[model samples]
Target chain A: MSPLSRRAFAGAALASLLVACGGPGTTTGSSTSPPPSVSEASVPPPAKSVAALGRSVPVGLKIPAIGVDTSVMQLGLAADGTVEVPPIAAHDRAGWYRHSPTPGQTGPSVILGHVTVGSYGDGVFRHLGELNRGDKVVARLENGKSAVFAVTAVQTVAKADFPTDEVYGDVDRPELRLITCGGPRTGDGYQDNVIVFATLST
Target chain B: MRRTGLSAMALACAAVLAGAVPAFADGTASPTPVPSRSAEPTKAPSPATSAEPTRAPSDDQVSVRPSGAPNTGEVTPSSGSATGGLIGGGAAAAIALGGGVFLVRRRRANGV
Candidate 1:
């Protein structure tokens, strides 16, 4: 090739090399299973961040959108030092982590439910993955008032990669997190945890 | 001229291979280290402020930070796949190879 053509080719090559090496992130392969449906597409962005309400113990929860209506029980730490889950026998009922802020209080209030209760079949949050953004989740409090939350996002993350900070971390506004086992079950148990994030809407 | 082209091809391949090594490393998901509660700084109020009856202690004050998730799943196997790296890597490698050939020829013509 002519010297001019050669120089042009070298410049092109350098550009390509930079582009290739520029982003090693492209090497991340597609997951074996389809990526967890963690879309925030439908949920409309809040016009304004919701204000927090006064503290009150959550007595019950209702997610009419996904048909989750269950009494909320209190959950403390287990012997293993992890947050507790609702009893396996009453897996249909949801339990709120007492350590977390109450439903209407500032910071994330966590609620845990089961997808399946052994042979008992579908649990209360079996359809939690179906919740979309803009959907409503109502938490009845001991003060005889209810806190309404709008779903912001739903994600199915590997149990090992459970987003502890995002789930339990403090937030300025009152927020709610619904957690349950999801994804294909392996010999160990459910492979992932389905988390639904919501912010106080009303 | 042919020698220059071959040398350029070799250099380009080496660059591509070198780039591919990191790509492979990046594809595998490393186990994330779980944080311990003891390692975290305590957010409790000082003793002087603990006994105030006028203001109820917040939930965080009364409660200990949870160590980890309350997940029921254990020993869940991770299935990581390695792909997509080739598409971008290959295209970039080809362009680099072309560039390498040109540069090599230019250098060879200059008799350096």
Candidate 2:
């Protein structure tokens, strides 16, 4: 090969390797499309319904099934606009998305937590995938009432294919979504997300 | 001359990989540890006593209804683009390394 062509080839190979590895602020392999919004009429009703609780800030969460009893922190959007997770030092704590409906309110209430922290290990939702249908989750509210929800589903999906609409879409009754990272590890990060869907119990 | 080019390419690749390891780690869902923060013990605020003033329930109260109208004070999730920080860094590295290769070729052509 000509000297000039050899140099060009080397540069091209390096560029391809960099693209395959990905860089900061870039996500590859995940679907970039917007989540589909399901109409309210199309949503199935809860198996057992209860009255929605009035406005109450969630302060703590307890899931007896997975032995989770962590304090809930109010999480707002990060500067990048995605929902923020709890700080690493507080990995044992779960964070409730303040913008979503408060637990027990009529909509999908989101609570996000870490699955693990680098070196620190074992985040609050590390065992979140173990939750099953018919298990119980309790959210202690600032109003001195506890919102009880029964687990409806548990799913682990690739981070690139996160079910945005199904997890964040509006619902007819008060619903709760607990999210954390799980599945196979890709270098330092997990390749998938674990979500627990639940609804208020009668 | 070929050995020089090969060495340069190897060095560039090593540097890019070194920078990428941490960036990949940062891309995880795990929260970054902040220096000044610790997990605060959360306490549920004291419940209102009967002596507290009670306001009449307003129509805006969250209720179990068939309608899917958004609740007041609820923040809708943002449809912001996800951060591809790792990918962006990798792309930048590629461009930088490519530029370095061009610079070397230019120097050689000039007989520098």
Candidate 3:
């Protein structure tokens, strides 16, 4: 075969590969890891040594499983009384809910992000739903300390059926919840929320 | 003649690399670091301490709760495609087109 022909063949073959695997998360362990199956076994008691950290406002977050590393902003109640979200333009960043306990202070610390940013593309949490059990999420606090948490569960539920209590209720140990829009998008916006439940691993 | 083949091979590799960069960028974070210090108990008491139910010192201390879950679904509008797709798809298309043009040029050169 002519040298030119070989080059053309190679180019075409690669283009085909790019198209076949271009979609995000298609080739990663984060998305392909199978969910753990439950069997008819008795549940074990909660870990008695669950550790809690001192109060320190989080300033940054990193989830190695999904390649999320960005500064965290504080989120407070919006004027309508709902919790405020980071500005749309700040789509790449996640926000920590100031009203909740600081990341390591006990109770459930809430963090939120967007799945997709308007015209800007995938937001910081676009791959969050792919987090499997035991994936680590690190939150860097203002005090120069970091709190690392591990995924316990990841659930997607309708916005109307959000598990507020399970998310915000007081817990016996420090926990974290990462939220983002998910499910089908409609006129009212995304119909469901992706929530990742994590407990302090360190 | 040998130089032409080298250039063509270089072009093909560059195009493929452009398309593959983003895919590889996704999981390039360095290994997770160990926390410098374990979570020490907070020395200061929460102002809302009274509202919290009584619990042993080992229990997670209760704190303020949000009135409700955040309404963040609209942070990204529904009408637009991500910029990433446009850039990535555009690069791949450009590379494919460039390759085709190169092949056609080579054929014409041989005919001459």
Candidate 4:
């Protein structure tokens, strides 16, 4: 083969290989599906309802008040002992901490999402600050059951002073904490984390 | 003609090396580290000296929901995708290296 053709073939082959080897768990920016609108008045009152699964694994999250309906990805801890966030490419998806109790379990189940991705624009939780007390947050479990939670409070605390105990504290009833970076942007990143505390309503 | 063969071999080798770099880097990167907190000793706390008592909510106020049905369906865990990435990168590196070696051997055999 001629030198030019040979080089061209090699370049094409390398490019194809790179595209094929693109990592897993990396979203292609196409998986995000629009969520349905839920209104605060439409939400039912809290009830002692049974969950669908004994150890329900949350697969999706929906907060109608803030217009958030996104798939949930399970996240493990990073090397630095901090919870891992979803890839920047998947800013539309929320990540649930796998180490924590599954939603509907008798402990705090934590769900995290990015507030904003650098250039791609607002993240899944960009409007998380708008959630108010008594808003409904629904977690759809893998077992086809849903865990509905009622927002009790929304607090924006400095990341330096994260209330780890309060967020992850053991509870007799199932609880949920939706976390995202918020407050003010600083040189490092978002200075504060917005945490919404919720209890299993049904 | 010999110079052309040498140039082709060199280009193939460079491509192989370039492909191998990412796989090598991934091989060196360790998996997520698990925290080790079991070494700390559990100590009994002394009784509170403060006059203020910790308020405990009444059982009636606490709501306990029954566990839902015992469905054993398993959801795939999501943490192993990084390993899949490493494997894909390694396979790409191997294929690139093998192609380079085959090209070099063909050129030499052809006496070009």
Q: In model 1, which regions exceed 4 Å deviation?
A: A1-31, A34-47, B1-63, B72-112
Q: How close is candidate 4 to the true structure, as a TM-score?
A: 0.49
Best by DockQ: 1
lDDT (10s digit) by residue, model 4, range A1-202: 5464467558656854874556532432211211111112223325564442356679999999999999999765443345667777534688886656778877778888888765567788888878888999999999998998988777766666677766766666788889887653433455567788888887
**Taking the tens digit of each residue's C-alpha lDDT, what string does model 1 give over B24-45?**
7776533232234433433233
Question: When only chain A is evaluated, what TM-score does every model earn?
Answer: 0.79, 0.76, 0.76, 0.74
Ranking by lDDT: 1, 3, 2, 4
lDDT of 3 by residue, A60-177 (tens): 9999999999999977655444667887774568998776777877778999998877667778888988888878999999999999888888787766777778787777788898
Best by lDDT: 1
Question: If you assessed candidate 1 against the hidden native complex, which CAPRI class would it receive?
Answer: incorrect
Candidate 1: pairs in clash: none
lDDT of candidate 4 at residue A103, scale 0 to 100? 88
Query: Clash pairs of candidate 4?
Result: A51-B68
Task: Please give the lDDT score for candidate 2.
Answer: 0.66
DockQ of all predictions against the true structure, Cα-based: 0.15, 0.06, 0.14, 0.04
- Give the best candidate by TM-score: 1
A-chain TM-score, model 2: 0.76
Candidate 1 chain A lowest-lDDT run of ten: A25-34
